[model samples]
Target: MNQGAPNRVVAAQLNIPRGTVGWWRSEDRKVRGEAYEQPTDCPQCTGREFDDVAYAYLLGLYLGDGHIISKRSQHHLSIFCNATQIGLISMAEEAMRKVMPLPTVTRRHKPGCVEVKSYTKHWCCMFPQHGPGKKHERKIALESWQQAIVDAHPWEFVRGLVHSDGCRITNWTIRLVGGERKRYGYPRYFFTNVSSDIRDLYTDTLDKLGVEWTHCTRHGNPYNISVARKASVALMDAHVGPKY
Candidate 1:
């Protein structure tokens, strides 16, 4: 109903909405306020335009034959399907629609051999190309990748690296605080990776916080010895556990 946006068209033959047909755009309330455009290509001909088909087929193959996505295959999928315009689910669905339709044709093969073939032949119609086991393999690999990164200090390291990679943080030797004998024996040392402009601010902050510090070289590095303890294996391990 919004101006300058695509309107819903009721196809007489199909009795269905043809404007961005069979997509979440129809279900979302936000689409009413935004602009819409007519699709240049047919949904059946376009890439992964239909999750109802592509993801469903992949899930079917995964459940029925235990196909898994692989690292190499995932990489390939990412390379080709990275952009939102050409995502894996949409591209895959397009591939499936070209090769296998709702009512697909099948043929039997010799014992122990998969005689998978497609009637709707095209560059994309390569269903059952990756064995059903591939999906399961990919699932396991993803789980392992996730688990390997879980509870790892490298995540914090990576996060800080990313955050301070280009952005300027206060550059100054901030004092480090050592816990009292009654408290946990946490190390104390100076930290000096702060930006030069905010060095005074950082210094004042540490001074007010009652932290101790001493000067050392390597001011730009995060491991500068301006804090409570010297940067060492023992000290690093206390914050981030011993590397396995």
Candidate 2:
């Protein structure tokens, strides 16, 4: 019955009465505390093909600043974006839909941000990293399958992480060149997260991409990764430009 076979069919296969099969199935469901769960197109659960690029990006977002709620009654995957960044919000929603189109996606406006959410319990299956406490307080590591996806689409994953908790900024300095004071601007990218594991993931991907970066300390805490090399900045500009 769980495999979508009718009670009569299952009973015939098991050589049992249809009524007995139905009763046993009902009891099993009751014991499992499972209601009639809607069928899901989750790639993990259904073994269906999904948008790998979108999944990689969404995975980065999930590890950076997004989260999943898997309560019995309320289940959703949410990625919060600054209210001012309408493009980022739209991209986040698009990524969610591309990965799993069946679930309904919605946005909730908060004080200074918008929460892009997809309603479904299957998100927990998609993102097994979802846990009970703060991400930085626990061990956060990618599964083998997820790492494969990230390796295949490293730029998209980096873009997603940057869009969530990273930024591109420019700093300038004045110098005397040919007796004239000129200002030169340096553009760099920074990914700041309290999770050391997440920072490692970001740096590991950067290493694969040949992007040079360094650890930055803020307020005496080394939770920031900076990409300031000229070549690295150019690479980032080409692939993961500033989040709009």
Candidate 3:
């Protein structure tokens, strides 16, 4: 749902058939729009509303695996990755609900198969030495920052290092350098799956944290979105280990 537009619901605005808009309302669905006060009931999370830091903290538990470019089972991998993200988010939500006085965060179900914008940020990474050899250049940098933080704190960190969507988090750390000698602080972040709420949250949180993040622009060699998605699923699957 684009902000400042009369379209209160995204599917309505897009003029997509009601029956085919299912993906828009799926579990762990993230929306993007302009800033507005959160209503009594969350537009995205149904009965569940944003609980400030508690919900934010729950989101911090998610982590991202660096993008991979596997040729085999690419489509299956993407599906699995999206599913895992939703599952991880659900798991975190459940964990938080047990301790907090909040309703369950459920999946969004618009209607049918409408394609909501993917949350994956398309960014490239660059290494100081390689200049070109690095994969997903700047995106890699964001992942690097995340990894660095996770390595140091392991359990208690929430750095908002992510690509374009400005909505990403993980259980691990993404590091940042400090002005002081060898002094660095890990900044943990909570992303609103909803773009409007998240944009508001990002601005408010960043301002509150006194940290600045540069927007990513198109540069360097391009990578396949499908490949990255597959890699992400594989990586997450590997990290989560085996299911009991």
Q: What TM value does model 3 have? A: 0.23
Badly placed stretches (over 4 Å) of model 2 are: 1-35
User: Order of candidates by TM-score, top first?
Assistant: 2, 3, 1
lDDT for 95 in candidate 1 is: 37
lDDT of 3: 0.30
**Runs in model 1 with CA error above 4 Å?**
1-194, 198-209, 219-225, 228-244
lDDT order, best first, reads 2, 1, 3
What's the TM for model 1? Answer: 0.19
lDDT of each: 0.32, 0.92, 0.30
In the range 1-244, model 3's lDDT, one tens digit per residue, is: 3232222344586787654444444322454443343222321334343333332233333212122223322210011123334444344435344323222223433333111111111111111111233222322222453334334432222322122122322333345556434533322222322223233333433444434433322354211111123343343233322211
Estimate the overall C-alpha local distance difference test score of candidate 1: 0.32
Residues 1-244 of candidate 2 have per-residue lDDT tens digits of 6886656678889999999988888899999998865657788889999999999999988888799998979999999999999899999999999999888799999999999999899999999888999999999999999999999999999999998989999989999999999999999999999999999999999999999999989889999999999999999999999888
Deviation in Å, model 2, residue 126 alpha carbon? 0.9
Off by over 4 Å in 3: 1-52, 57-81, 85-87, 99-197, 217-244
Q: Residue 214's C-alpha lDDT in candidate 2?
A: 98
